[model samples]
Target chain A: MRIVVPAGGTGGARFVRGLLAALAEAGEPADVTVVGNTGDDITLWGLRVCPDLDTVTYTLAGAIDEAKGWGRPDETFTVRDELAGYGVLPTWFGLGDRDLATHLTRTSLLASGATLSEATATIAARWGLPGLGVTLLPMSDSPVETHVLVQHPDDPAGAPPRLVHFQEYWVGLRAAPRALDVVAVGAEQARPAPGVLEAVAAADVVLLPPSNPVVSIGTVLAVPGVRAALEASAAPVVGVAPLVGGAVVRGMADRLLPALGVEVDAGAVALHYGASLLDGWLVDTSDVHAVAPVEQAGIACRAVPLLMTDVPATARIAAEALRLAEAVRA
Target chain B: MRIVVPAGGTGGARFVRGLLAALAEAGEPADVTVVGNTGDDITLWGLRVCPDLDTVTYTLAGAIDEAKGWGRPDETFTVRDELAGYGVLPTWFGLGDRDLATHLTRTSLLASGATLSEATATIAARWGLPGLGVTLLPMSDSPVETHVLVQHPDDPAGAPPRLVHFQEYWVGLRAAPRALDVVAVGAEQARPAPGVLEAVAAADVVLLPPSNPVVSIGTVLAVPGVRAALEASAAPVVGVAPLVGGAVVRGMADRLLPALGVEVDAGAVALHYGASLLDGWLVDTSDVHAVAPVEQAGIACRAVPLLMTDVPATARIAAEALRLAEAVRA
Candidate 1:
C-alpha cells in the first residue's frame, strides 16, 4: 500500500514512526511519503531552518533526542551560545550545534539556487531515507511562514495586535499570549511541492497524523492546490486528533484553537477539517463522546487510544486509524 | 605612540600578542592598528570565513587555542563533521563550532549590505579589541581572493596550469604542489578598506609582522593605494623576517616563495620589498649574512633572536623591531 502523511513536528513525527511500526508488524509492503509543514520555517543567523522537516528526518533516522522529541541527540549549544555572545537577536530560539549542520547544508544549497525541495532531498539522502522506504518533502518549495497576531503586552487597551513568527510565538514566547489570528503568509501563492499532489492522488491511504489543524496540517492545506487535490483524491482520507481528553498531546494546539473560534475539543477539530477533507476521524477513548458528534457531521468517527506514550502503544493507535480508513472506504 | 602593522594568520597573530605586551611593559601609550590580510578569505558553506582577521581577533581576545595558534580554545568540530557527512565539497578546511559563530555573524552582516570592513569592526568589537587599544581592519572592502596557479596533478604535461583557491592549495592540498603564480584576484580594481590609508599615514611607526610575504603582506600591498601610502608615510617602516636560516618560522612561505622568483632567504625577501617600502629589516641571528646584503639594497637591516617561543620572547622581538624603527627615524 502507498501512504501519504501530511505532518508537523513532534507529534506528527511520533505518529509516523508508529505508522511505520504498524505497517511492518502487519507484514504490509508500503511506501510512505511525508509532506512536512513549512509554515514553521524561519531564517535565523541568515540560515534557513525547517523545524518540522528536521524533526521528522532526525526521528526516523533514530538520531532524535527522545526526551525532547525534537532536535538531535547529544546536541551542544556552542554555536548558539557564541551567537548570543555576539549579541545576535532572537535569542529565544535554541539552535543547537549539531542541528546547525542541517541549516548550513540547506542554506548553502538554496543559496546555490536549489529549491527548498531539492535542498531537503539532499539532506534526507544523508540520513538514508530512501533505504527506509520513506520520502520526505516540504509542503511547498516556496517560502510560507506562519505568523501569529497577538495583542501587544504593553498596550492591553485595544491596540492593534503585533505579528510574530510562529516560532517566536511558540518557542520564544512559549505560547503565553492569546493568539488573535494565525496567518500562513505566502500560502495563497505557494504551489504544492513537486510529488505532493501526485502522492495524494496516487495513495491508497492518506493520513493526517495528529498535527495541529490550525497550523500544521491546516497550513499545508492552505497551499493553493493541496486542499483541492485531497478533495479530488479517490483514496480514503483519515485524520488522528492532535487533542485527547480536550487537551493537546503536545504543542500549543489548545492555545491556538480558540483563535479560529473552534473549541479545543476533538469533535470541533474534526468539524474544522470537515467531511470534505476527512473520510475518517480518530479521537481518543477519553473523548469518546466526540465520536457521535463527529459522525453527525458526515465524517466517519472512531474512538481509540490516541496518546503516543511509546512506539508500541502508538502503533496500536495507528492500527486503529488504518482500520477506520478501511471502514470509510467500504 | 601610534603603531600600524600589516599581518596574516598564526605567526602574525602571535606577533601582535607580543607587540601588545611589549608596549605595556615599556609604559608606551599606543594605539595599534592591524591591517589584516583578506586574500585568504573564502565563502565556505555560503558563509564568509575570514581566517586572518579571526586569528588576530581570537589571539588578542585570549580565546585562541594556544597549541594550534588559531581558532577558538576548546572548539568543537560538530558542524564541520556534519557538513562533511552531507558530502559538501571542500572538506579540508576545519571550521570549528565556536569559530562558526563568527563566520555566521560576518556572512549575515555582509549579506545585509555591510562592507567587509564594517563587518570586521563589528566582530572586533565583540572580541574587545578597542578595550585592548587595538583596531583591526581588513586590507580592502572589495572581495579579494588569492588564487594559486599550480600544475594540475592529472595534467602534469602542463595544460596551462589550473588555478585553485588559496585555501585549497594551502589547506586542502597542503601546499604540496609547485605554485606557478599567485594572483590576488580583484586587487587591481580594489580600493583599500576605509581607514587603511589614514592609519598608515598617521602611524608613528609601521611594522610588517613575520607573516607569509607572498600571500599575506604582498596581497595587502596589492590593494591599490596601500603600497603608495606606505612609501609616502613619514613613519619609518620596519619588517620582521618570516624566514629564519632560509626556513619559514611557520606556514608555507617556502612552498609559495619560488613563484615570485624570490629565494626563501631573508635578504632576498627584503630585496623583494625593496628600499622604497622597507626602512629597516629584522633578520634572525642565524641569517646575519643577510644583513649586509639587505643593507646594500639601501634598507637598514639587523640580526636578532627571532624565535617566538612564547609571549615574552616574542615581546623581545617586537622590542627589537621598534628599536630598528627608532634608528631609521633618527
Candidate 2:
C-alpha cells in the first residue's frame, strides 16, 4: 500500500511512527510518504529552522527527545546560553546543542543555493532512516512563515499588526493570544515541495492524522497545486478528526479553530474539510453522535476510538482508515 | 595619562588586564585605548568570527576561559558540535555557546555593512566596560583573514595552492607543518578602524604586548596610515617580546616567526620592529644577555622577566615598559 501522510508537528510525527511500526509488524510492508508542513519554519539566529521536518526526522531515526517530543535527547543548549549572554531576546524555544548541527547544515545549504528538499535528503541519509518506508517531503520549498495575527481588544484592525511566527505563538506564547487570524504569510508564492503533488496523486490512500487542521492540513493545501492534486487524485482522501469531545486532544487547536469560524467539534471539522474534498471523516467514538451530522453534510463518516495511546492502537486506527478507504472505492 | 595598546591575542589581553588592575591600584587614572588585531578572523558554520577582538573583550569582562585563556569560562559548544554533526569539516576552533551570539551579531552587522570598528564599540557598550576607563578598538575596519601557506616538499605552488586559514594551521594542525609563509590575505586593502589613528596619535605611551608579531602587528601595520600616525606621535613606542628564554610563551608562535623570516628571539623581533618604529623594546631577563644586540640595532632595549603570571606582575611589566619609553623619549 502507498499511503501519503501529511504531518505537521510532534503529534503527527508520533502518530506516523506508530503507523509505520504497526504496519511492518502486521506482515504487510507498506510505503508511507510524509508530506511535512514547513509553515512554521523560521529564520532564527541566522539559521533556517524547520520544526516539523526535524521532528519527523528525529522521531524516525529514534533520536528524538521522547520527553519533549522534539529535538534530540540529552541535547545541550550551550549555544543558546552563549547567545543569551549577548542579551538576545526570545529565551524560550530550546535550540539544544545536538539539534544545532541540523539547523547549521540546513542554513548553510540554503545560503549556498540548495533547496530544503535537497538538504533534507542529505540529512536523512546520515540518520539512515528506513527510506521513511517512504519519502518525507516538505509542503513547500519556498520561504513560508506562519504568522498569528491577534487583534488586541484595545486596538482593533490589528494592534500595530502584532505578527508572531507560528512557533513563537504556538510554543513561546503557549498559544495565549486571542488570535484574529492565522496567516501562512508566504504561501501564495510557495510551490509544492518537489514530489509532494506526485506523491499525493499516486497514492492509494491519502491520510490526515490528528494534526492541527489550520496549520498542518491547511498549510499543505495552501501550496499552489497540492489541494488540486488531492481533488484530482483517484485515491481515497480520509481525515482523522483532530477534535475529540469538542476539544483538541493536544496543542492550541481549541484556540485556533474558532478563527476559521469553525466550532471545536467533530461535525464542524468534517464540514470545514468539506465532503467534496474529504471522502471519509473519522470521528472519535465519544463524538459518535456527530457521525450522522457529518454524513448529512454529504461525506462518509465513521465513528472510531481515535485516542492513540500506543503503537498497536495507532495501527488499528491506520487499519480502520485503510479499510474505510477500500470500502469507499468498492 | 591616555594609554594606547596595540595587542593581538590571549597573551596580549592578559597583559592588558594586569596593566589595568595595576594602574587602578597605583591610583593612576588613565584612559586606556586598545587597538586589537583582526587578522585571525575566519568564517565558521557561516558566521564570521573575530577571535582576537572577542579575546580582549571576554578577558577584560572577566568571563574568559582561564585554563584555555580563550573563549568563555563556562563555554558550551552547542553550535560547534551541531555543526560537526552536519559534517562541517575542520571544526578545530572552539566557538563557545556564548561566543556564537557575538559572532551571530557581528556577522549580521557586517553583512548589513557596519564596519568591524562600529560593531566592536557596540559589543563593548553591552559589557558595561567603559567605566573601567578603557576603550577597545579593532585595528582595521575591513575583513582581513590570515592565511598560512605551507610548502610540503612533496607538494608545491603549482599544485593548486596549499592554503589554510590561520586558525586551522595554528590550532587544528598545531602548526605541525614546516614553516613556509604567513600572509595577512586582506592586508593590502584594509583601512584603519575608526579612531585608531587618532588614539595612536594622541597617546602618552604605547605598548605592543606579546602577540604574534607577524599576523597581529603586521595586520595592524597593514591598515593604511596607522603606522604613519604612530610614527608621528610624540609618545614613546615600546614593544614587549612574545619570546621568553628563546621560546614563544604560548601557542604556535615559535613555528610561525621563522615563516616571516624572523628568528624566534627578543633581539631579532626588536630589530624586525626597527629602530625608527619603536623607541624601546622589553625583553625577558633570560634574554637580558641579548639586549646589547637589540640596542646595537639602534632601538633602546630593556630586559625584564616578561612572563605575565599574575595581575601584579603584568602591571609591573607594563609600568617598566612605560618608564623605559619615557626615559628614551627624554
Candidate 3:
C-alpha cells in the first residue's frame, strides 16, 4: 500500500515513525511518501534552510536528536556560534554543524537550478531513505515562508501588528508574542511540487499526523492545488489532533491555533480541517469525550493514546488511525 | 607612516604577525594595510572562501591554530565530516566549523552585493583587527582563482595537461603531481580592490611577506593596476624570500616555484620581480653569497636570519626588512 502523509516537522515526523513501525510489525511492505511543509524554510547566511524538511528527514534517517525531536544527533552549534560571532542576525535559530551540510548541499544544488523537490530527492538518497521504503518530498518547489503578525509591543492600542518570520516567532521568541495573524507568504502562488499530487491521488490512505494545523499542514494545504488533490483523491483522509486535552503535545500549536480563532480542542481541530476533507480523526484518550462532536461533524473518530512515547506506542496510535480510516471507507 | 604589504596564506600571515610585533616593539604606530591575495580563493559548496584573507585575519586576531598555522584554534570538523558524508567533492580541504562561519558571512555579504573589500572590513572589525592598527584588503575585488595545469596521470608523455583548481593541486594531490603551469584565472581583467592602489601609492614603505612569490605575490601584482601603483609610488618596496636555502619554509612553494621554470633561489625570485617593482630584497643568512646576484639585478639586497622560529625571531626579520627599506630609500 502507498501511504501519503502531509507533515510539518517534529510531531509529524514522530507519527510517521510510528506508522512505519506499525507497517513493519504487520509484516506488510508499504511505500510511505512524506510531503514535508516548506513554509518554515528560511535563507540563513546564504544557505537555504528547510527546517521542517530537515527535521522530518533527520528523524526518519535515525540521525535526529531524539531529545529535541529535531536537528541531527550529536549536533554541535560551532557554526551557529561562528555566525553569531560575525553578528549575523536571527542567531536564535540554532543550526547544528552536521545539519548545516544538508543546507549547504541543498543551497548549492538549488543555486545550480535544482528545484526544491530535486534537492530533496538528492538529500533523501544520501540518507538511505529510499532503502527504508520512505520518500521525503517538499510540499512545494516554490519559495513559501511562513510570516507571523504579532501585536506590536509598543502599540498599547494594537493599531498595527509587527510582522516577523515564522521562525522568529516560533524559535526566536518561543511563541511568547501574541500572534495577530499567520500568513504563508507565497503559498497562494505555489504549485504542488512534482510527485505531490500523484502521491496523494495514488495513496491507499492520506494521513495528517499531529502537526500544527495552523502553520504546518495548514501551510501545505494553502498551496494552490494541494487541498484540491486531497479532496479529489479517492483515498480516505485521516487526521490526528496535535492538541490533547486543550494543550499541544509538542511545539506551540496552542498559541498558533487561537490566532485563527479556532478553539484548541481535538474535535475543534477536526472540524477546522472540516468534514469534507477529513474522513476520519484521531483524538487522545484524554479527549475521548470530544469524539462525539467530531463524529457529529460527519467524520469517523477514534480515541487512542496519541503521545508518541516510543515506536510501539506510536505504532498503536498509527494502527488506531488506520482502523478509523477503514471504518470511514466502510 | 603608512605601510602596505601584499600577502598570501600561512607564510604571509606569519610574516604579517611578525611585522605587527616588530612595529609594536619599535613603539612606532603605523597604518598597516595588508593586500591579501585572492587568487587562491575558492568557492566550495557554494560558499566564497577567501583562504589567504582569512588566514591573515585569524592569525592577527589570535584565533589561529598555531600548530596548523591556519584555521581557528579549538575548531571542530563536524561540518567537514558532514560534507564528506554527503559526498561533497574536494573533501581533502579541511574546513573547521569555526572557520566556516567566516566563509558563510562573506558569502552572504557578497551575495547581498557587498564588495569583497567591504566584506573584509566587516569581518576584520568583528576580529578587532581595525582597532589594532591593521586593515585587511583583498588584492582584487573580482573573482580570481589559481588553477594549476598538471600532467594527466595516465599520460606518460605529458602531451595534454589536466587543469585543476590550485586547492586540488596543493591539498588533494598534496603537490605530488608536477604542476606544468599555474594560472591565476581571471587576474588579467581584475582591478585592485578599493583602497589597494591608494595604500600602495601613499605608503612610506611597501613590503612583500615571505609568501609564495610565484602564486601569492605574483597574482597580486598581476592585477591590472597594482604593479603600476607600486612602480609609480615613491615608497621603497621590500620583499622577504619565501625560499630558504633553495627550499620553502612550509607549504608547496618549492613545487610551485619550479613549475614557473624560475630557479628556487632567493636571488632568482628577486630577479623575477625585477628592479622596477622591487626596491629591496631580503634573503636568509645561509644564502648571503646570492646577495651580490640580487644587487646586480638593480635591487638592494640583504641577508638575515629569515627563519620565523618564534614571534621574536620573526619580528627581528621584519625589522631587518624595514632597515633594508630605509637603506634603499637613502
Candidate 4:
C-alpha cells in the first residue's frame, strides 16, 4: 500500500515513526511519502534551517534524538555556544553541532542556486531516506515563513497586535504569549515542490499525522494547489486528531486552535479540516464522545489511543487510522 | 610614539606580541597600527576567513593558542569534523569551533554589505585591540588572493606552471611542491584599505616583521599605493630578516626564496626589498657576514639574535630593531 503523510516537527514526526513501524510490522513492502512542513524554516547564523523537514528526515533515518523527537542524536552545542559568545542573537533557538552540518550543506547548495527541494533531496539521501523506502518531500521549494500575531502587553487596549516570526513565538518566547493569529507568509506565492502533488495523487491513503492543525499542516494547506490536490486525490483522506483529550499530546495546539475560533477538541479539529477533505478522523478513546459529533459533520470518525508514548502503542494508533480509512473507502 | 608594522600571520603576529611587550618594558605608550596581508585570506565553507588579521588581533588580545600561535586556545573542531562527515571538502584546513564564530560573524557582516576593513575593525574591537593602543588594518578592502605557480609532476617537459591558490599550495599540498612564482591576484586593481597608507605615512617608524618575503610582505607591497607611501614617509623603514643563520626559524622561507631567484640569505632578502625601500635591516648574529653586503647595498644592517624563542627573547629582538631604526633615522 502507498501512504502519503503530511507532517510537522515533533508530534507529527513521532506519529510518522509509528506509521513507519506499523508498515514494517505488516511484513510487506510499503511506499511511504512524507511531505514535511517548511513554514517553521528560518535562517540562523547565516544558515538556512528547515526545522520541520530535518526533524522528519532525521526521525525516519533513525538519527533523531528519540527523546526530543527533533535534532540529531548525540548532538553538541559547541558552535551554538560559540555563536552566543560572539553575541549573535536569538540564542533561544539552538542549532547543535550535528544539526549545523545539515544547515551548512543546505545553505551552501541554496547559495549555489539549487532549489530547496534539490537541497533537501541531497540531504535526505545522505541519511539514506530513499533506502528506507520512505520519500520525504518539502511542502514547497520557495520560502514560506510562519508569523504569529500576539497581543503586546504594553500596548493600549485598542492598539494593533504585534507580529513575530513563528520561531520567535515558539522558541524565543517559549510559546508563553497568546497567539491571536498565525499567518504563513508567502504561502500563496509558493508552489508544491516537485513530486508532492503526484505523491498524494498516487497514494492509496493520504494521512495527516497528529501535527499542529493551525501552523504546521494548516500552513502547508495554505500553499496554493495543495488543498485542491488532496481534495481531488482518489485516495481516502484520513486525519489523526492532534488533540487527544481536549489538549495537544505535544506542542501548543490548545493555544493556537482557540485563535482560529476552533474549540480545543478532537471534534472541532476534524470540522476545521471539514468533511469534504477528511473522509476519516481518528480521536483518542478518552474523547469517544467526539466520534458522534465528528460523524454528524459528514465525516467518518473513530476513537483510539492517540498518545505516541512508545513505538508499539503509536504504531497501533497508526494502524487504527489506516483501518478507519479502509472502512471509509468508496 | 606612532609605529606601523606590515605583517603576515604567524611570525608577524609573534613579532607584534614582542613589539607590544618591548614598548611596555620601555614605559612607552605607542600607537601601533598593523597592516595585515590579505592575500592569504580565503573563503572556506562559504565564509570569508581573514587568517592574518585574526592572528594579529588574537595575539594582541592574548587569546591565541600559544602552542599553535594561531586560532583560539582550547578550541574544538566539532563543526569541522561534522562538515567532513557530510563530505565537505578541504578537510585539510581545520576551523575550530570557537574560530568558526569569527568566520560566521565576518561572513554575516560581509553579506550585509560591510567591507573587509569594517569587519576587521569590529573583530579587533571585540579583542580590545583599540584600548591596547593597537589598530589592525587589512592591506586592501578588496580581495587580493595569493596564487602560487608550481610545476606539474605529470608533465615531463617543462610546461608553463599550473597556478593554485596560496592556501592550496601551503595547506592542501603542504607546500611540498616548489613555488615557481607567487602572484597576488587583483593586487594592481586593489586600493589599500582605509587608513592603511595613512598609518604608514604618519608613522614615527615603519617595521617589517619576520614574515614571508614573497607571499606575505610581497603581496602587501604589490598594492599600488603602499610601496609609494612607505618610501615617501619621513620615518625610517627597517625590516627584520625572516631567516636565521642560513635557514628560517620556522616556515618554508628557504625553499621559496630560491624560487624567486634570490639567495636564501639575510643580505639577499634585504636587497630583494632594495635599499630605497628598506633604510635598515636586522639579521641574526650567525648571519653577521650579511651585514657588509646589506650595508654595501646602501642600507644600514644590524646583526642580532633573531630567534623568537620566547616572549622576552622576541621583545629584545624588537628593541634591537628599534635601535637600528634610530641609527637610520637621519
Give the top-scoring candidate (lDDT). 1
If you assessed candidate 2 against the hidden native complex, which CAPRI class would it receive?
Answer: medium
Among residues 3 or more apart in sequence or in different chains, the pairs in candidate 1 whose N, CA or C atoms overlap within 3 Å are none
TM-scores for candidates 1 onward, in order: 0.98, 0.95, 0.97, 0.97
Residues A1-330, model 4: lDDT tens digits: 899998889877888888878888987576889998999999888889999999988887889998887898988887777677666345689888878878988888898899999888888888888887888889999899999999766668988888888998888887888888888999989999999999988999999988999999998899899999999998999999998778887888898888899999999999999987999999999999999989999999988888889989989998998888889995
lDDT of 4 at A312: 95
lDDT, candidates in the order shown: 0.92, 0.82, 0.89, 0.89
Identify the superior model by TM-score, candidate 1 or candidate 3. 1
Winning candidate number (TM-score)? 1
Candidate 1 similarity to native, TM-score: 0.98
What clash pairs does model 3 have?
Answer: none
Query: For residue B27, what is the lDDT in candidate 2?
Result: 91
Best-fitting candidate, measured by DockQ? Answer: 1
Error of 1 at B72 (Å): 0.8
Residue B95 lDDT (model 1): 93
Docking class of 1: medium
Candidate 3: tens digits of C-alpha lDDT, residues A252-290: 988988889998898899999998899999898899988
**Residue A318 Cα positional deviation in candidate 4, in Å, after optimal superposition:** 1.3
lDDT of 3 by residue, B72-190 (tens): 99988988888887884457888889998899899888888899999999999999999889999999899998999998565679477878888878887888888889998999889
Backbone-clash count (model 3): 0
| lDDT of model 4, residue B184 | 93
Query: Model 4: per-residue lDDT, tens digit, B1-330?
Result: 899999999899999889999999999996899999999999988789889999998888899998888899988887777777667445688888888888888898888889999889888888899998899999999999999888856557768789888888888888888888888999989999999988987899999999999889989999999999999999999999999988988888786787789999999999999987999999999999999999999999989999999999999999998988999986
Ranking by lDDT: 1, 3, 4, 2
lDDT measured at residue B232 in model 1 versus the true structure, 0 to 100: 97
lDDT string for model 1 (A83-174, tens) is 88888445688889889889988988998899999999998889978888899999999999999999857666978889889998898788
- Per candidate, the number of residue pairs that clash is 0, 4, 0, 0
